[model samples]
Target: MKKQFLTLAILSTPLVANADNEAVGTPLTAPPEIAAVFAGSAGTARTAEAYDVSPAELDRAIATFTNGMPGDSAQWAVALKKSFTAFEANHPHTFGAALGAFLFNNYLVYHDLPLDDAADAGMKSVIAQYDRLVREHPEDYAAADKEKYINMIMAGSYAAMVLHGHHQDKSLAGQYAFLKSAAGSALENYFKVPVDRVVLENGQLIAR
Candidate 1:
């Protein structure tokens, strides 16, 4: 059977600044409203049925990712990839929104930023890393991996839009359009593809 790959889900944890100035991880609780989103309760757009992954399972995966973190971005990326791969191997459904929720919470905690700021910065950081990998390390990214990463980033972006719309009382269409434009621009810049080649639909990224 073909396995479905999902995006990276980060666990929300308090990080202490260590001697090396790296964020050391500790368990942190997310706000109830935000946690509800991770539990697949934001709306029809965030339903577990929508992604084919149970909320409990996604929570388990999030915990696994959180507990495994060694701090710092490089190590965090490694941990995120490992967690994502493991979840993909075991689950029949996707968990991109769960991953997005984790990442969104982590950014809020790590940056001490407001929701809007955290979402904006966090999504950009993820897309930027993906862009760098495909542009500067094509030999390492691979085609399959590239597709998975793109899906994950876009799914994550969709989750962010859901959250923004829920909390900020914004229009989902507007949020999606903004995110799509940003992601489309990145794809065009890195792969020389047309901005319309990849599109977000029903909370997932579809590549043409």
Candidate 2:
């Protein structure tokens, strides 16, 4: 059915729901933005040519897309962990109800997806878990975090790949830069996270 869904729209995972439980620094916090990683942005995988994708080749493609190039993945994982921790620490929620509503609304994005009953049911189950957690532990999580996280997702989701002015190449880095810049500003100003774009690799903020 093609699912007609993005990750948020499916609610298969809550991006920052359990963020506080993980000691604020862990590998699970970072999954490379898939669309960003697949920046070639071509639908040309489908051609009139005889596609020789067997079960094994299909599996291999999925694995490569999921785990990425193994050695470089570790480096990105560490970067994502550090980056997310710095973001959350600088933003804390003042109202519990707002946090609950924010998470609930985020899941509702998936209702717009075109899905078969089984897929919809599965997605609903996932959302239910997040709703339960957010409702039960409002003190442990924050609305500010949810807002910032959603903003990041929305920005990335909206920023799709584009053919680079007749070059036929998609700019993966451009999408990343746009997402980072948009989310960075939103986290800093809207959500009151003290994020500086110029943070040093040592986790120290630069003097503005």
Tell me the spans in candidate 2 whose CA falls farther than 4 Å from its real position: 1-4, 9-115, 143-146, 152-208
The residue pairs found clashing in candidate 2 are 9-110
Cα lDDT of model 2 by residue, 65-146, tens digit? 3364334655533433333333233222222222222222222221221234554354344333434444454443322233
- Model 1: lDDT of residue 22: 18
**Model 1, residue pairs in steric clash:** 9-99
Best by TM-score: 2
- lDDT per residue, candidate 1, 109-167, as tens digits? 22223454434444444433333322443232222222233234334432342334434
RMSD (CA, Å), candidate 2 to true, equals 19.8
Worst 10 residues of 1 by lDDT: 1-10
